[model samples]
Target: MEKDKIIKYGSLTLVAIFILSTLSLLFLNSNPSVNPNNSVLQGYVIGYAKISSYDKVVKVQNPTKELEKLLEDLSKNGTIVRSFNFENELVIELKDEKDVYRLNKLFNEYNSSIFADAIIDFENLTFFDDSGKQLSIPNQRKKQKITPLFDIAEPFKIKADAIVGEVSSKEPVVYLLSISLLENEKIQIALKPKNITLISYAISLKIPWDSRSYIYDLSSKLNQSNITNKVNLANYLFFNSTPSNTSLSQLASSNIPFISKITKSTISLNNIQTKKDEINNLLSLYNINVIFPDSSIEIENLDTKNINFIEGLVSNYSNLNISIQKENLVEVEFYQESEYGSTKYVLDEDKLKVRFKTALNPNDIKNISVQAEVVGNKIKDYKIQQEQ
Candidate 1:
């Protein structure tokens, strides 16, 4: 009887063990196990689908090729990881906790090896568990976000101050300058004229100074024929202004009074000014005539014949002094101190004579005078002065 009881108990124990093993296998099948190819996460698994599946999705910005490789590996392993693209961002969806944990582990391992420089950030990696809980990633690192050295508007202010501070000559009460980057990566400098009120507001908002007197002075200075003074005024207006985040091309269309010039980065404004001064000095020293055309010359008052005569005469000499004594007549006197001998030229089929004579002055300066009165395309009265 004792041997029979022992056998019965052993048989019952074996039967119980079989039932428990079968149930365990069924439970495992219901909650799929992920083979993450990792020894540390060997037993880690996902639970069966409940009311809620994925708590949250993972998002990545500016993803690199390594991220693609990681997803490809999981797809090759028969894991269903769905990915959706949204403009610059990539959204990844995992089936359950098992898949999330699997991907998370694989990503960390691959990221450490492939992205040692942290170029592709692991900080963008976010994971969640099956129970609708956020999972913290392991071996995660933080990256420093980059920012601009100065404000966008601050550069314009700084450049304006620097321009104003370098004024060696006359300083305008108010000036404005702007700089912008060109499409070819070149820098464009613009000198713009603004209202005195604008300058007033810029200098002191509390007490807006009436800079009308200064503006009048600047206007009068600009009206003069001196290129040196004009350039100085341009510098005053150009450097004492503001900068803009707007493009240079757009500002050009507004019809605002401004002088813009393109230059290289290696040359400073002071250097530019010095170079211009040196050029002017050289021209003066050599007595070289540089003719700059005037767009504002009025020819409305003169008759066609006089205009033609003046045009013909002026074209002969670049350094001629034009004197319009009357509407019908004009005189052009050009000093050719270096040239000798007499020369003749024809204006509209009218012959003109030139004479060279010594001046009565003590310097013994020779005068070459060309006096002519044409009568029906014929030379009548002509005088030429030569050195004594």
Candidate 2:
């Protein structure tokens, strides 16, 4: 009897273990955890949906409370939310990749359409998962893939016209016009004048101060052109602003007033002689002959010795009048004279101080030439006056 009871208890324990294992398997299938590849399904929430120009709303119904809540949250985030039950579809428009990924993950985890027996439609849109991996659905209405509006070989052109009123306000009244080529066809857009303000606002946000002035100037020109189209304004502001390789010839042809003011402040030299000497010294350092003298003074040749003679003279005579002349040869002239009536007998004791100017070149000096004659107590002045 004891052996039989032990056997019965062991059999019951084995049966209970089998039942628990089966329940675990069923639960795993019903609520599966995210896989490594499908990890993007986590931490994302629906943002919103937008209906394109080609899209039409047939009917909207939100049966699942979860989907309804998701749509409400997305609508608050500036997305156009649309739901249609007759077509058995839930369409959500997203602002950016972040929102698109969020909604995609929610749909994957909830198996949204599978549970609701509805279809998920992404109209005129594309999506990427959290890892930047593309998510493609099978057996859905084919979305028309829009090639970028502008071609790779062309860039968007911008043009505007405006009239400046005599009012105190700085705002420029504008008239805007724009045209774009799509699928090798030209499309003209019309924009109202008020939209010009929006374009200005966007320009101020994106462009620097200097560039912003150009855009503002364009706005003023637009206001003056008498443009009555609002669609043109939107196209020029948003579509043209994006990166493109489209030809902007038409946009460039529009005339706009752009003014650039460059103010330059002038600096005047207080002492002309000092400035001339300084400039000569700089020139001499480059092995260039800039100074030629009217008279002769025996000094070390600068070309042979590479010695700076003008720099030494300026250092010695701080108030020396240094003049530069360009004739058959460059000349540096200097002179100083004293007036006197008293006479001394000794020629050497005459106490005559002769001031002479010297000319030197980086090349060989063949002979010295003096153009002025010196009288008693006076040296001839051959100073060449330079225009300031």
Candidate 3:
């Protein structure tokens, strides 16, 4: 009896150990913690190019081989570069006047680009100061004594810093020269009229200050000048601004006016496009097929539980059909049917068509599952014949 009791206890202990081990393995597989580097943000650019007027001409002098090399590197790295005449000065165009501020902020972080002997002739530009003063062409150049700003060691480093916390406010200032120049002569002289004033000065210094105040001041000045509802210096900065926290992938997605309003889907789509192009270039690098159907599929009545499943199916099969029923459960149909005489034949095309009564909210998604069927070309032909 004693020996039997010991043996029974041993057996129970072994069973418990086995069960615990199995549970541990399952938990680890389901809730795997991805490393930060391997996370989806790996290959994204944290900063984006700002849109600017095309009036500025960049000229480079008897370019040293080093300057040429730098230009080549900037171009390859996706920096916007436009040549002005035969001069070696390469004009860096920004998206908006606010972007001029961002460019200045970037300058504080990296000062090497400032030594290029570039002159920003805003002679044709008209702007206002913080005191509602009319800032016109051939305005006096004011030199402000400001602290020096540090340069970022690498682009990724700046991105990492932004992800960790808010950027600092104290930054350097630059000498700003306000002037009015002809738009036509802007390209000829390499000067453009940017809708900005104090903000332009702040940017030239590489300060990270928000342009809202500067923009407001400019608007007040422009309003006095009878410019209504105009996207002048102040309003443009307010509307087309992006947050400093924008990710690299988000920056590369669209040429939208503001970076702050960028969505995850847009970023994901851009990433998908890039990945697809890469796979096409090196087909042997990946095992999965990247081809997707040309037509759009609709899904309806998807709740949290089955939305994941539908997405997985679409991701795996490249085609799917979806529909929502009574706003409750999501009904997912994988196969398409066609009528033939007295019977209907099912097609093996791994495409899904989906229609949704309403748009799915991004936050409501829960668990996802996908079911796939492998069919050959011959199977597709047979199904077509049966339906016919």
TM-score of each: 0.15, 0.19, 0.19
Instruction: Say which prediction, candidate 1 or candidate 2, comes out ahead on TM-score.
Output: 2
* Pairs that clash in candidate 1: 176-241, 177-241, 354-384, 355-384, 355-385, 356-384, 356-385, 356-386, 357-385, 357-386
Regions of model 3 farther than 4 Å from truth:
1-115, 127-249, 256-388
The per-model lDDT (C-alpha) reads 0.26, 0.26, 0.25
Q: Model 1 over residues 194-225: C-alpha lDDT tens digits?
A: 23243222212110112222332332333354
Residue 315 shift from truth in candidate 3, angstroms: 26
Model 2, 1-388: lDDT tens digits are 1210111010000000000000011101112353323322311111111113111111123337776776787678766444333224343334432444455456555554311111122133333333444445232312422111111112211111110111111211221112111111111122222222223321111222112223333333343433323222321111111112331211110111110111111111123433555655654676645432324211223332333444454446555443322212223322132111121111122322222222333242222222222333233222221100
- Candidate 3 lDDT, tens digit per residue, 33-126? 5443343221111011111222221222244566557556655765544433222333443223233344434444433332211222211222
Candidate 3 Cα deviation (angstroms), residue 34: 70
Judging by lDDT, tell me the better candidate of 2 and 3: 2
Model 2 bad stretches (over 4 Å): 1-65, 73-97, 109-388
lDDT value for candidate 3?
A: 0.25
